[model samples]
Target chain A: SQTIHQWPATLVQPVGSPLSLECTVEGTSNPNLYWYRQAAGRGLQLLFYSVGIGQISSEVPQNLSASRPQDRQFILSSKKLLLSDSGFYLCAWSVLGGLETQYFGPGTRLLVL
Target chain B: AQTVTQSQPEMSVQEAETVTLSCTYDTSENNYYLFWYKQPPSRQMILVIRQEAYKQQNATENRFSVNFQKAAKSFSLKISDSQLGDTAMYFCALASGTYKYIFGTGTRLKVLA
Candidate 1:
């Protein structure tokens, strides 16, 4: 069985501070990874997705960016955090190629103050 | 471009009752996929059900099922024998032969005990 892990699970960052959220998938290789954000009382907004290592596609350009440094490791980062950047950040993985079901991690709740 | 819509913003159902959450999507592609994801209070996205466009039969997983109308572009999720643990935000998503997934705004479901 495959499992996705994310941390710190919850984060509190001050404005203009750097942000880094990590996601790693166990028992899967070459999986498609995605980054998503959900504001309070809202749905998900896809931020970035990667089909392979060093290949990242931005769905909505904003303060955040994503990188797949390793096959099973994906990281969401920002040089500076904004108040608007506070939300529930989700990391998901799917089978390689298209139209596969995505599995999500426990998620990281970032509160930018 | 593909888009998903969930008409209900919030709903409540008594325990053991059946509730249907409406979802509709727009896509020009003939072959694609639709998915329903559940986000509990923990904000972990759990895949509830999925439907492939090529399959004629609607997909069902235990107490969860989907009404997939390809022509109507409607894909609704039905939760039978709802439980208190079913209280969460349900999101409808569409993947059209790409890495991109468009998600609905989400419907908050409360299974009252």
Candidate 2:
């Protein structure tokens, strides 16, 4: 069985503060990772996706960035947070050849005050 | 680029009744995938069902099923014997050849008990 884990389930930070949200998958290797943000009462916006280590494709150019340090470890970071950056952050993983069925983590609720 | 559309912003249904959520997508690729995801309040987003473009048979999981019309570009989800747990934000997504997914605006379904 595969499981995805995310930390700091709920975060409250002031403006200009740094942000770091971690996501890791167990029981799978070389999996594709993705980062998405969902604003209140809105659809999900894909932010970044990685095929392999050190390879990240950003969908929306914003203050956030993503990094794949290991095969199953992905991190979403931001140097400075904005009020608009507050939302629900979700991390997902899928197999390389299997294009469908993306598993999601519990997610992180970030609030930038 | 592929695009997914969920016209209904919100829908309500009585418990034990049936409800169908509409989804339409636009894609030039023949071989692709369509998925329905559910996001419960204050919980993780999970996959409900998936349909492959190559397959003609619709996908079904327990009480959830999909009506996949490739020619019409419509993939609607039907929930039978709906329960209170069925209340959530439903998202329709399309993935074609790429590793990323294009998500619709989503439909908020409220199942009244």
**Model 1, range A44-106, lDDT digits (tens) per residue?**
888999999999999887888888889999999999999999999999999998889999999
Clashing pairs in 2: none
**How does model 1 fare in lDDT?**
0.93
What is the Å distance of residue B76 in model 2 from its true position?
0.3
RMSD (Cα, Å) for all candidates, in order, is: 1.0, 1.0
lDDT of 1 at B29: 90
Off by over 4 Å in 1: none
Q: Is the docking of candidate 1 incorrect, acceptable, medium or high quality?
A: high
TM-score of 2: 0.97
Off by over 4 Å in 2: none
DockQ of each: 0.90, 0.75
> What does the TM-score come to for chain B in model 2?
0.98
How would you encode candidate 1's per-residue C-alpha lDDT over B1-113 as one tens digit per residue? 67899999999999999999999999999889999999888889999999999999999999999999988999999999999999999999999978888999999999998
